[model samples]
Target: MECTICKMGETKASDITVALQRGELSVLIKNVPAEVCANCGEYYLSDDIADKVLTQAEVSAAKNAEVEILRFRK
Candidate 1:
């Protein structure tokens, strides 16, 4: 698929790390499955994966985690 952010790039399946931050919380999740743009290094995650990632982040934020590092679980 072509990348939306970078029209010059094609997106390919890859495992990438996602960093998410909110208010006083920061989360880094690694080994996430996504479509990555070859040119601009943009990434897109599927709805299911996005939901899971957000849920995990929400859990950490609920725990008042200032920073969290986690491995993606299928």
Candidate 2:
């Protein structure tokens, strides 16, 4: 698939880290499956993956976490 951010780049399957922030909360999720742009290094997560990541971030925020690091698991 072509990367939306960098139209010249094609995306490949890869594992990457995702950083998400909300107000004072910061979340780092590692080893996530994504489509990564070879040229621009931009990553695109699938709808299911994105939903899971967001859910994790929301859970962390609900716990009043200032920062959280998590490993993605199927």
Candidate 3:
């Protein structure tokens, strides 16, 4: 698919890092599956994966973590 941001490159399956922050909490998830733009480096995650990432971030926020790094399990 064409990238919306760049409007110049097609997206391809790639491994990416998703960084999320909520108030005092910050989470960085590595090795997540995504479709990335070849030109602009924009990444898109499916709704299912996004939900999982949000859940993880919420858990980290609930724990009051200032920063956390996790590997994507799925």
lDDT of 3 at 58: 82
Clashing pairs in 1: none
Q: What C-alpha lDDT values do all the predictions have?
A: 0.94, 0.93, 0.91
After superposition, candidate 1 runs with Cα above 4 Å error: none
Give residue 61's error in model 1 in angstroms: 0.8
RMSD of each: 0.7, 0.8, 0.8
lDDT of 1 by residue, 1-74 (tens): 99888699999999999999999899999999999999999999999999999998999999999999999888
lDDT of 3 by residue, 1-74 (tens): 99999899999999999999777778999999999999999999999999988888888888889999998878
Between prediction 1 and prediction 3, the one with superior lDDT is 1
Instruction: List candidate 2 stretches off by more than 4 Å.
Output: none
- Arrange candidates, best lDDT first: 1, 2, 3
Which candidate has the top score in TM-score?
A: 1
Please give, for residues 3-73, the per-residue lDDT of candidate 2 as tens digits: 89979999999999999988999999999999999999999999999999888888999999999999986
- Model 3, runs deviating above 4 Å: none
TM-score of every candidate relative to the true structure? 0.95, 0.94, 0.95
